[model samples]
Target: MAHTAEIQCPRSISEEDRARAQFYQLLGTLLSAPPSSELLRGLASLQGDETLLGVASRNLAALAERTNPQDAEREYNTLFIGVSRGELLPYASYYLTGFLNEKPLAELRTDLMARGIKPRSNVHEPEDHLSTLCEIMAGIITGEFPCDRNLISQKAFFDAHLAKWAALFFTDLEKAQSAVFYTPVGSLGRVFMAIETDAFAIQ
Candidate 1:
C-alpha cells in the first residue's frame, strides 16, 4: 500500500517476462496513485482474454468508479492512519529487526545509493518503504536496474526485506476491517508474493 515509485521496464526482456513485469509495474503504479478517471480508462482497456490480472484490472476499474468517496476515505485512514497504527507495519526495518528505522533501513539505503536508486523527492517515507521495495523487486526481475538481478541478489534482498513481512502485510490487508475493493487486491498480492518466494527459492 506504500507504493510510490515509477519503475520503467527494459525493452530487452523476453515477451513472456515482459508481460509479467508489466503486471507488477501496473500494480505498483495503481497503488502509487489514488484512482483517477484516466487510470479508470486505462484499466478498462486492459486485455482480459486469459489473465487474472486483466480481470482484476477490469474489476478494479469498475470498483473505482462506483467507490463512494466517504468509504474510500475511511478505508484509506483505517489502513494507513489508524487511530494508533495499522495492524501491518510495512517497513523494512520493522520486519527484519523487529524495530523501526533500524540497521536494515540503513543497509538498504546503502545498496540503493550504490545502484543509483533514490527515493522520489515527494516521498516522505524511509528509503526501504514497502512500495519502493516492490518497485525494486519488479525492477530487479525485469533488469531495469543497471546490473542483472541474479538469484543471489534477489534472494538476499527479498529475504532481508519482503520475504519476512510481505505475506503478513498482505494478510492484514486481506482482513482489514475497512477493506472492500482492496481485499481481492490483498489476496492477489498474498498469493503472488508466496509464489514469487517459492519460485526464487527453487531457482
Candidate 2:
C-alpha cells in the first residue's frame, strides 16, 4: 500500500531527472492503490502530450475525466485484486521465474538490504512488487533512502531487478481486458521503462 505523501526530494537534481523520478513516483502511487477522488480529479486536469507517452497521458486524463472514484476502485479490484488472483500478477518474481516468491524476489531482497533500504512495515507485498520497484527507482534518483547511491549503483539495480521484467508487465497491463484507467498507466510505465533501459545502457 502506498502512503498518501509526496515523493521526497533529498536534494536538487537536473530538472529532467527530477521529472523522471516524479513520473516513477506517480506510477508507483497509482499502482499501489486505487485512486482517491482527489487523485482522479488531479489526473483529469493533466494535459496530454504529442509523443507516444503523451498520447497515453491524454487518453488516461480523458478517461479520468469521466470516471467516478467508486467505478475506478471497482476496476482496480477487478484488474489487480480479483477474489483470489488478478488478471495479471505484477511481481518481478512471477514475471521472471513464473512463480511468486521465487529466486528473483530473494535476489531483490538481498540487493535492497545491501543498499540500506527496507520495505515499509505496513506494506506486506514482497519487495518485488511493481509498485515497490517503482518506489525503489524513485528513491534511487531522489536519495530518499539513507544510503548515497550514485548513478552507477542505480543502473546496476535497474539492470538486475527491473530492466528485464517491468516492460513486459506494463505491456500486459496495457492489453488487459480490465484496463481502462490503467491503460494509460501501462503506456506511461512501458515508455518510461524503455527510456530507462536505453539510458542505462550507455551510462
Candidate 3:
C-alpha cells in the first residue's frame, strides 16, 4: 500500500503533467522487465501525439518482435558487467555514495518498511537495485498498491531514487560497446528521464 502522511502528490502539477507522470511510471516498469509477448501486445494500444516518446514507442514496437534474448543478453552483459566492468555501475548507491549496500540501501529500507513495501523473498538483489526500483515504479503506476496513491507514490519514489542515476545509466547504455537493439532502449530511457526530471523540477 502507498503511504500517505497528508494525502498529496509529491509535487503540485497541472493535469497534463500527471498524465506524463503516469508515462514515466509505466516506462520505468517496462524497462525493468525483458520484453514479453503480452507486454508487447499491450503497448500497441497506446497512442502518442507526435512527441519524442510517441515516435520512439512506434519504433520500439516495430523492433520488439524481432528481439532475440540471446542477442539482448550478450549485449546486456557486455554493457552492464563486461570482462572487468562496464563503464557504469547502474546503481543508486554506487553513483551517489561510491559503493553498493551503502547508506542509500539503508535509507531505502527505512522508506520501504514505512510504506509497507517488502522486497520479494525470492528476489535476492538489494532493494536499491535498479531493476527492483523499476519494478516498484510499475507497481505504483499500476495500482498494485493497497491504496490508490499511485501518482504520488510514483513521484516520491522517482524523486528519491531513479531521478538521480537513471539518466547516467541510460547514457552509458546508449554508448556501451555491445549495444544494438538496446541502443534505442537507451535513447528512450535517456529522453524519458530528461523529460521526467524536468517535469519534476518545474512541479
**lDDT (10s digit) by residue, model 1, range 132-174:** 6877777776776664566676677678767877777777777
Candidate 2, residues 133-169, lDDT tens digits: the string is 8887887777677556578978988899989989999
Candidate 2 local accuracy as lDDT? Answer: 0.84
TM-score for all models, in order of appearance? 0.75, 0.92, 0.72
Local distance difference test values of all predictions, in order:
0.66, 0.84, 0.65
What's model 3's overall lDDT? Answer: 0.65
lDDT of 3 by residue, 153-192 (tens): 7678789988878888878777776766666667777888
Residue runs of model 2 more than 4 Å from their true location after superposition: 1-9
Off by over 4 Å in 3: 1-49, 83-87, 147-152
Best by TM-score: 2
**Which pairs clash inside model 3?**
none
lDDT of 1 at 25: 65
- Where is the poorest 10-residue window by lDDT in model 2? 1-10
Better candidate by lDDT, 2 or 3: 2
